[model samples]
Target chain A: MATKIDEEQLMNDMLCRVKAVNNMPHDIRATLLDFKVDGYKVGKVRPGIAEMLCNMKTSVFELKQEDDSKKKSYLTLTSDAGTSSEERTKAVGTVMNQLRDEGFVKGWRDELFPVSENFYSPPVFLMERAAVTVLGVLEYGVHINGIVQESRQDEPKMWIGRRSATKSKFPGMLDHIVAGGQPSGISLIDNVVKECEEEAGIEESIVRAGVQSVGAISYENWDPKSDKLTRAVQFTYDLYLPPDFEPKPVDGEVQGFMLWTMDQVKESMAMDYADPIKPNCYVVIIDYLIRTGQISPDSNGFLDILRELRSGDCQ
Target chain B: MATKIDEEQLMNDMLCRVKAVNNMPHDIRATLLDFKVDGYKVGKVRPGIAEMLCNMKTSVFELKQEDDSKKKSYLTLTSDAGTSSEERTKAVGTVMNQLRDEGFVKGWRDELFPVSENFYSPPVFLMERAAVTVLGVLEYGVHINGIVQESRQDEPKMWIGRRSATKSKFPGMLDHIVAGGQPSGISLIDNVVKECEEEAGIEESIVRAGVQSVGAISYENWDPKSDKLTRAVQFTYDLYLPPDFEPKPVDGEVQGFMLWTMDQVKESMAMDYADPIKPNCYVVIIDYLIRTGQISPDSNGFLDILRELRSGDCQ
Candidate 1:
């Protein structure tokens, strides 16, 4: 007899495939041109950078010729002009400002993200948070999910929020109680506490007392639309709230909040074809389900889901 | 400042590197040649199969020439000889018996393992449990870990076992209270109960009542010594026991049992340089630590470890 493909299995398979795409190495060698400075690999430069740089006539950057190995030529910062990390940061910042002014990039928050070989190393240089992906550099984020179960109930329920319609990405989609990207300065715990209050209107005292660190999920994806490579590590947290406490949207990013039972959450997750939740959020929920023993090993594709959840590198 | 590498992070990094090795894809396209039965990809035959087939003078099997794609030539079964699944099973069984007789293979068991594209697919054929790895076919195993904790403790201690000195694999090494591969014909729950009795001498009533399905971890590794690709899916279970109950080894596989605190377990896992436990078994214990909130997100390499745990595909 042929094996039966159940709803849970189908959902799990879909998530796994998504993870594979995200975890697959960025073939910058094949797609974007490789940029190097002073014998060190800097980052990937998008193809469109040539025309943009030409239009801006930047003194700090130049388009270099392909080497004998036939690797694609790249737009690199002039080493004579900016040899030091500080000078390079300043030079790149100037180009980023020009790009932002020309309407080539959006959402300039003045926040900086480190461009590094791996997370556990000193960054080569810092770039604007908005332009990190545009430059195809690795970035990291933190996602704090609140598990608000009624004290009297036998089964726990999860608190979920809807992204505001005005949000630039994943607007009107379901999200965790609180989620945000990790910028250069703040620590993970501090970020979680800050996001809890700003995103969910949760009190600082409650968040500090109840929040527990769970784990993380990482994935690397190339966005063809933006011609960017996005390598992200999402640090996940579980915050338990009092049963009677209701969450209000303090920040405009969240539209509304709702508490759903496990069955309801699973049902939502099983709609793999639908965009009920943001893509990465789906993985975080699946990880929660597996860790909490809601997704049993006997379930179809349980192993597939577990293996896919950790497919990417954290560094 | 240079990025601070903490002990936890270092341990997590070590675990991730180990997982990467285990999870890396086997280029079946490169090392072992592929064998096709009818049109379906049946199995991977080792390079040595050519000489072995010639030595045995087998009528059912023949070595095919390499194709234009430059793919490796394979030792395939003659179509006219084994059309039906049963016939194919019998034909392969005959060759496997011959190989065993010739001392090319070892550890022959009457038990069968299903060879399939994925865990959910209808198996192409059944092979002797011990011979599955010899053929380099994708294999699935269930690893049911008994999480025995004392009822009286504030922070529960775990029941761990040391393998017998006479055991062939991982002799005198640490192991779960109960663990065994999923043999054919037995359901996961039934196998868990049986393994619990045989390995840990747990009562049937206690196992049936306390055993809970948790999740699974999948990894693919190429065994250089045997020149075989090992694809495994371990179905993990958590069998909670009362604090006072002691685990006695019924089967001689386990030499002794000990109850260790979380700190002790962490210390053992942190010993990345030593093979304190079987490699894959280390992953299972890490999963346990993460699930029980012993390994926090704040812990160094926590994210790396989480991602590595789920780095392979079961399907």
Candidate 2:
């Protein structure tokens, strides 16, 4: 017998996990300090992160509180860093290196991401990609859902990736067909073509013709250690594949690819509580299902789930 | 000559108009009171509405202020109203009738709308549909876009309706092919079918097969007078029509129907700023444009628009 599904619970659980701090009813986020760069409040970090940065004893960040309440505290880059983004980035980088040596930050990807208020805005500064999530920065990326449909009778089949076992993150877990962090210099569509080719062995011409940018799913996650806030905006897309197309794994980012019927995708996402797809990308699939008219509007918590999908600082 | 479009400005203006109190830099909502029923904050009303309700001195409401500042005041249903939803509804209904008589309310639809925190929940009370918006409540409705796309070379054409001049609200304005409020008994899909047949003379079989529940666009609008708050969740859908199918205005609700290509539709929505489509339905169209990928991922304020599309209390 197949396991029964509590779809509302599954969705609520996923949303709460993906946007832990946002789903709270009370102002529990007051415990977190506003993280400022060059005097502009851009992100947030836990009290522990504030203390850690302060203990580094650098003039980089000045942590202050209000009215005898630690709850009202904030950390801002000092005037010493000045207004030049380059100077601020270099100053922050020096502190980050010290943090790495002291074992406070890890997983250095060497890829740098610009920190900004929104995706298309000018950067406040640049930070190492891997450290972006760990240091509570707003990160943006693209995720696409590839599917095949000849007609309604066949029930459109969607393509999903299983991360390689040796991968550093989300290993052996299911994910979207093509996903990558947004680095400076490349256009979003061009980046989509590049990632599609590198991750799924899809041709550039096919990707350019097939892919369509839908929108975005933003989430605010409290890292497992509960000391960092990871805010992410996944720019979503939908790619209609030729019925006969098959995706072979090109790079080791993904272990393998499989085509799942709409039913199978729903089952994996809604019923696979034992292990779900990467929490953030999991929401993108639900969004795709909704857009394709698979998820009924009468489903309980439909409104809540739709809103929570973009629950973070969506801009 | 075609008018150049400032898509970002158009969307921002529509969103600001639809969700006025929401798109603020700070919480101007502090001016409004939490309208409570059965001790639950089910809605929010302008301070004027609160005072108007209490002025009657009917023992139905007891307004309280916090910190001697009106900022934190809430109007609650007195204990005399009891916990019986039916009794509370009857008591509130009596007041609604009186308010209508005194000209504080208008447009009695003779339709009843349930009061609850979210859809698919038991009612806290049932109020007249017309007063639901004037009195501040979360209203639910369904809107669908009907389109025909035979191939890639031909841009998809969508069917839109022009409201009859005789209608009281948004007369002669552009609207979706089929849209209706969610009543108490019918299923959402069934509501779509009923509205489709009644408004567009579409056959039941065709609507049942072609129409789909895509998702929702919720917005919070402060009425033109900036008094009442109208929080609405419009469940959206997409219906694929046969290439030859054309919608005829039925039941005198619509003046006529027009089929516009995607470019035409985008132009009407993005460029016709002097006289735009109905504000709430306008949001539904932007959502459709995004889902179909007509709006690029790199558009400025892409993230903000996506989030604000469902800017109301979605649940």
Winning candidate number (TM-score): 2
Worst 10 residues of 1 chain B by lDDT: B1-10
- The C-alpha lDDT values of all candidates are 0.70, 0.75
Report the C-alpha lDDT of model 1 over A68-147, residue by residue, as the tens digit.
67765776667645666677788888888987898777888898777765555567677888887666666677887678
Return the TM-score for each candidate structure.
0.82, 0.91
Say which docking band candidate 1 falls in. Answer: acceptable
Evaluated on chain A only, model 1 obtains a TM-score of 0.79
lDDT of 2 by residue, B1-315 (tens): 346656786556545544543442235465767777655667877777788787785648778765454347888787777678888888888888887787767778888899886787788989898887655788889998988876433467888888888888888888788888999778899899889899999999988767777888777766646466777778898888888888888899998888877666666654335655666676787788888887787777666667666555534
Error of 2 at B273 (Å): 4.0
Off by over 4 Å in 1: A1-56, A59-77, A149-153, A203-205, A270-275, A303-315, B1-56, B59-76, B148-154, B203-212, B270-275, B291-293, B296-315
Clashing pairs in 2: none
**In model 2 chain A, where is the ten-residue run with the lowest total lDDT?**
A17-26
